[model samples]
Target chain A: MTASIRQMGVITAHLIRKVAFNPAVVWLIAMPLVIIYILGITMHGLFSAEFTPVKPYRIVVALPEEAGFLVERISRAPKHFAVEEARDAQEARQAVFQRQADAAIVAADGDEPLTVIAPPGSIVLEMLAGVVQASLEQEAQQVAAAQPPVENGSREESDTGARSAGAADGALSAMPWEGVGSFEYFSIGLIVMFMAFASHSAMVHCVQDRSTGAYLRIRALGVTRAVYLGAGITSGMLLGAGFSLVMAVITWTLFRVVWGNAAAWALMTIAGAASVASLSFLLTALLPSDPKGVENAGGTVYSLLAFFGGSTVPLTIMPRWFSEIFSWLPNRKMLDGYLKIVKGAGVKEIEQELFGLAAAALIMLGLAWLVVMLLKREEV
Target chain B: MATHAAVQEARGQAAGDPSIVVEGLRKSFGKNVAVDGLSFTVHPGEIFGLLGPNGAGKSTTLSIMAGLIRPDSGDVKIGGHSVIRETQRAQRLMGVVPQGLAVYEELTAAQNLDYFAKLRGIEKKRRRQEIEEILELVGLSGVAHRKVAQYSGGMKRRLNVGIGLLGRPRVLLLDEPTVGIDPQSRRHILDSVRRLAESGMAVVYTTHYMEEVEYLCSRLAIIDRGRVIAHGPIDEVRALAGDAVVLRLPFPRGVLDEAAKVESLQNTLPMPVEVTSGELRIVLPQGSRQAPAVIEELQRHGVPLDGMRLESPNLETVFLSLTGKALRDGKAAEEGAMA
Candidate 1:
């Protein structure tokens, strides 16, 4: 294991020197910053003008200890919903009753159903109730499947084992935040997009190695194929993730864009790096060891992922089917998570996006391994 | 006192002990049969050469020994470690200098050596010293800090050889390491390989140039169409080549119609005669004894013959006489190279 790690370290250094020393790397990093600035300034007005062209529905929420996860699930994810924390259930209900807030949700703490407060015939009333009922119904079914038929267990709809795990970390503080500015949104989107491109560009080393027979040389020098490939992927991931973080810092310092909590942004950047690196590895391994083939395939995949995933073209301008179908792309997931962070969401709120990115990395890595094994078998 | 000299001595095994054992190797690339039941062994402190025309499976055989390709039926053992079953350990005992330049162009020569040394599991502290010594050995110490992209072809080839010298393995496999280079650089590489063998490292040298094999290797195998046509010490292989002498008779380009003259010679002369690019060669069945009869016959055919020379049995002669094809068959070699 020590020898493997040492080999990985050496291969990483080789890759870094090979990739970072090239003059084109300067353009690869600098171009994105320029594009983000220009596009942000150009598209400022479009983002400012929402479809409704009215104030967002102000939903005053009261989390009774255990229901923070459900309220965050329901209140978050939609940029159009603005949230405010009510001090207590009475205050939440009174504020809506007195016409100060559009709606209020008093979540169930333990053994008690949630309460909803809204004016009659108000759109917020029906929307909030319907979302909360759907969540409660899902929770009810989970409770039913987890336990035997106990009449008293029905009231156990409080924060369960899974939801309470986040409590120790602290409450899910969905701070009062406004929507992202055009510059901030574009900066995050382009950073994610360029990071993927950067990973693909980093793979030029592997292509050159293969053509020059350096890969076979390295393997003959006692390094396994897996170790050589892993070193490349890990090194590219670090370089790409570091580059994205630097971009975030630059935007935050220069354009005054808030990328949410630092820890969350860093995690999201690492996750994005893993996904892009694995995608590059799989593409290289699956192709016919030709640089042009890898390049063309990567270019097509990157372009499509960005086009439909809100990086190249905004989801607002995309067709509904595109929005529905391609929204699950890794790039799309990254952009969505980054936009939320820009909107002041933290690690807890973007947990699913983080999980999705991690899962994508694992799946790509697994597929790359499978392809390499098949090729080796055929060679044998 | 330097790390390279010390490492060389410390890692050096006893000379004349077999370090490579290739047994019944068979590999077929979709029916091409790259290496068919080939076998050989090389001992420490000896240079074993494999000579064959293009596509004679020289590179493929070296690749199998380097653990890059898996043979269909047999195995290569590096100092008792199986290249197939214990590939990593076997690889650690051997190094491969590939036909192409494997050094990274973006990195300095020293940097390339240092990175490969590290990947070879040399500790960080010893890596700098080892890399410096390697640069000195490859005659690149003066320009070690320059990127390989800026180096001349000979310098790049030298660095390619230097990378294979990283771990001081028991065996080294060099597949035409000096294909196209300045004569001085080629000389330096040959001297370095000699020094390596002196330090008790077994070297497997493959080349198209027969003189290189005669100058460096004590034993060699002549492979033809994925099979060993001749194998043994230099004298033994030459003995197998027989006492048949090659007679080179030159003629002005336009003076001889190659096709008509070749037909005329084949029909009239009672010897194996072939027309090459610039000359006609007739192999004397019996040494210089048959030379006069061949000359008289050529003269009787109204063939204008320049001063002819009788070339005795050598590696090239052995290769041609055994394989029935010139060692450097120009057209076939070009096509093989392109492939």
Candidate 2:
């Protein structure tokens, strides 16, 4: 057993050396970083705070007698809320149906104080409703404070009021700009995608070795099949980890994107590496001995996976149903885990995603083993 | 000198166990039988040659002996370990150098040797020394640090052999190790094989080049159509052509056109006369005794000879006699089938 381990170590070292000198590996490692950097610099204005939308949320106010006052109030935060005056409820509803406005508000002289009508399943409508609710609540609080204090208030009531006020303050304080910039988010995606490709290139090395007779030579040296395959996997993982480190350094130093929870990031990195390596192995094992065939097939499959996994485009811009489907992909989970780590998510919060990635890695590795076993039998 | 003596001593210690026993080996690829009921053995200090045309089951047999492939119905044992049942032990006692160059082109010669040494379970402390000795044995010590990609064909072939010699196994299988290289390198490789056998190692050398077998192999097996047609010591196998001597008489075209005249010459020549394109070949049972008479009769008939020569039998002639075709013809047929 020790001898096998030693042999695996030797093969792994040789594979690593081969990768280190390979020009293709160097290009694969540098490509994603260069592309992300260029995109970041050229599209800097798109992510700047000053380039806020002119009118993000359009709302029509139709309150009859109080329409002007409500419109003025809603329009105070013009960058976030765009208010348009309507002649009446009918006009307001017509405007929303025509898609001229995202939503409409109607003041009522009934028990419900206000009525909000918007398109079904619209995120913009949800945010508008939240904003309106918060505004109304603040107004009601001020009106209450202006009145005389009640002298017979119970001590339990006062403590409850104080706790509620503190909780509201905490929520407000936590509501700062916690979103990731487009450059940073896409950079992470590109890094994950490149790592997958780099792992595939490692499998390409395996194919080359086999074609060039190096594999036969080592096998004749008494190296077991398991040791040979184990060495390849180990080398791929090491190469992936190295690429991840370079990506992390470049992003941190250039874009100042900080990762959260070092332990979680490390775990995610390892899981991601295993997933990519095993997937590459499975794909390569399925291909025939022809190197060109393997390259073309692997390239096509990986490109399709990267596209559907949100590496080519952000899931946020994709249709909701499509993004949901993308969410099930391992590369998508890898990107999500890394993004969450960068957004200050703790280990426990991202544990399920990490588990998914780990499970995927294990399953792929198992499949890869079965494929290799079949191939070995055919070889014999 | 010290390294050579050390190798000698190591081989001497391993001499008692240096025997490769192949028993009833049979293998087939799908419907094509590559080897059929083949068996052979090599004792210590012997160079056993496997001479066959292309696709004649030489490589398949070698692969089975090296434990790289499992036979369909038989087994190979090296140093008392079955290749199929005791693979690791059997493999430890054997080394294989494939027909193709198997060294990594991106790595230096030293690095390639070092890597294989480690895989062969050589101790790290002695790896450097062993690598140096192997490089020396293959005459590649001077270019040890150069990348194999930059080396000449001979250099790479030498490195390939060096990698196979790292563990110093009792049995070594070389499959066409000198296929395409300079003559100097071929000579060096042949010399190395001779030295290895002299130092008490059993070597199985496979090649298509007949001269190599005639010069190096003490005993050989000639295989055709996945079966051994002839097997024995070199001279004994050559004697398969029998006592007939071959005489070549190149004549002018149309010199022996008359059937009656040819029959008359045949009756007087003391041998059978076979006429081919512009030449007359005579196979005599005792050429030295009847040579003068045969030449005088041919001259008397005015056969118009352009040139005349007498030859002895060799491996090529023996191969032709056994298979009824030359080795080149067999190779061409194999190529045509493959194409």
Model 2 steric clash pairs: none
Residue ranges of candidate 1 with Cα displaced over 4 Å: A50-179, A378-380, B1-16, B247-310, B329-339
The alpha-carbon lDDT assigned to residue A189 of candidate 1 equals 75
* Cα deviation of B251, candidate 1, in Å: 9.8
Per the 3 Å backbone cut-off, how many clashing residue pairs does candidate 2 have?
0
The DockQ of predicted model 2 stands at 0.43
Tens-digit lDDT string for candidate 2 (A1-380) = 99889988888878877877788866886788787877667545444545445456788877645324445667787777778778776787678778888777765333324556665324454345545555555555655755311111111112111111112223323321225676777688788888877667667777777776677778877887778888888888888877888888877887787877899988988888888888877877887366677677778877888889877765543433455666768888888888888888888877877899889989999988888778767343
lDDT of 1 by residue, A1-380 (tens): 88888888888877876667778778877887888888888766546633331466777887664566566666663654577888987787677767777777665455444555655323354345445655665566776665312112121112110111111112112211125677887787788888887787667577768778798798888777767888889877987887787788888887898777888888888898999999998888887378788888888988877777777665533323455576668887788788888787799988988999999999999998898888755332
* Candidate 2 Cα outliers beyond 4 Å, as residue runs: A42-178, A378-380, B1-18, B241-339
Residue B325 error for model 2, in Å? Answer: 5.9
